[model samples]
Target: MRGLFLLTLALMVPGGVQATLPPPPGGPTPAPRLVSFAPPPSVVVCKGGEARVVESAPIHARIWQPWIPPVIGRAAHQIPPPPAPPTADIYTFSIDADGAVIDLSRPMAPTMWPGDEQAAALAKWRFAPGAPIKGCRLDLAPTTVALS
Candidate 1:
């Protein structure tokens, strides 16, 4: 009887059945899920004019974040998507005499915006005048539909 029961149990179990199950319904797809992130303050302070500040940030083209579907978007898109991911922005910030963030600038390229949201969000930024920026705090938050 014991031998018979053991055989029955072995037959019931599927051969090589993967123990791990797929993602739950309405869950994120297992895609490449590309995410690019730069630690806060890529470029610190530069003692030149405004032009110098812009030069400090890596002025190049590179993907910042990869967007996924809504369910997986937030999870995969943890980093802030560049106006144009994979493309570096001509980023610059200025502080007033009081060390408050006064002027913040990010030049837009053709790739920056697929829609109007990017332009609008970038324009609305207001930094404290003369804000003593110890590092490059570009787009302090994620640029998304909700935040933008």
Candidate 2:
């Protein structure tokens, strides 16, 4: 009776029943199961506050009188520019994630102040990479900044 029972049990059990899928046409499929999958969380750390000025551009442009001859002596060398009208243009700009200055614009640029030169100078500025910031103000000639 015991020998018969053992033989019956051994024959009933299946041999090497692997829980694997059929090979796919692309390649053998990976056996990883995505049970309750939640993607990893990401936190964006932004740098803010005042942007330090590393390289500074001169805000003043000197004027030289070409008509004044060399006979005028040292006085002809450096001629101070005429006083600019009380027109201050505030340039608005932002910094990108790569710390490069972007979105530079001056709504009402003064005639004497070259907007292109000032904007180009600001564009080359690179600060610490950070989140998007708006409402940054820069007084053109003075180069005063209120960056956030």
Candidate 3:
């Protein structure tokens, strides 16, 4: 009978039987998958101001004080003195760690238009690498007094 049907087709041809085939119902045997290459946190602009890296640190003031002169005054106030009342200018500083300008002071009160060019443009401000605000107060944008 054709040599017993070629020995039952060589034992039904499927060699290893798919290695005992039994892992398809998803039950147990899946614990070998861990991959992490690192290097994914970098937003450093801390040479005077600018930083970002929230979940992994380095979240300092990213570019503090770009144009804080809503109106400092004296663009043209020549020969019109005597009627002063409105005033504001409280510049204080302390930003180090790369963003320079440390321990700057400016407790304004008596104005005749002389902030030394706004303290020399905040001493060439620059910021980054934060968390070191010892007395950082630069409030000079509040002049809406019309109580008449």
Candidate 4:
């Protein structure tokens, strides 16, 4: 009974078993050391004049999606004025290989929204860097964001 209890206690203690392996031929391995280096400078330039617009992908919601307020019921004899329809302003710009906006053209004439607002939003936009486009044209459209 004493030997059986001792064996069971040894089994329960994880330190009772250990893994041993031969050291590497070189000797004990050295601790890993971190190496840091700066990346090469990236310079993207748009060719003189406008680049042919290969394909104008639809504006992604992550970039700019408008919000529409819900209509609440008013009290009797208290009719609330109808809400004005949301307006959309289209913008054109060029992007580089890394999706950085190389050159941002002025907003099309007669835009209800301000150009600076559109530019500020666009500055945060990024695209996959595969094929580099010289002067790509991007269109930004406004649409209501659906609530989940």
The number of the candidate with the highest lDDT is 2
Q: Write down the TM-score of every candidate.
A: 0.29, 0.42, 0.23, 0.34
User: Which pairs clash in model 4?
Assistant: none
User: What TM-score does structure 2 among the candidates reach?
Assistant: 0.42
The CA lDDT at 126 in model 4 is 61
Give each prediction's root-mean-square deviation over alpha carbons.
13.5, 31.4, 28.1, 23.5
Clash count per candidate:
21, 0, 7, 0
Off by over 4 Å in 3: 1-47, 50-82, 86-92, 97-104, 107-139
Number of the top TM-score candidate: 2
Would you give me the overall lDDT of model 1? 0.39
Runs of candidate 1 with Cα error greater than 4 angstroms are 1-32, 47-85, 110-148
Against the reference, the lDDT scores of all candidates come to 0.39, 0.48, 0.45, 0.45
For residues 44-92, write the lDDT of model 1, one tens digit per residue. Answer: 4435423113212222222334443444234444633323333343445
Put the candidates in lDDT order, highest first.
Answer: 2, 3, 4, 1
lDDT of 4 by residue, 60-133 (tens): 23332223233335332353343332344444556676656656765464323345655665566565454555
* Overall local distance difference test of candidate 4: 0.45
Model 1 CA lDDT for position 55: 18
On lDDT, who's better, 1 or 4?
Answer: 4
Q: What is the lDDT of residue 7 in candidate 3?
A: 81
lDDT of 2 by residue, 1-148 (tens): 9999988877888783458754333322223221111221121122445654444344333232122122222232354433334346567777666666678788777554356655666676666556655555666433222121
Off by over 4 Å in 4: 1-88, 143-148
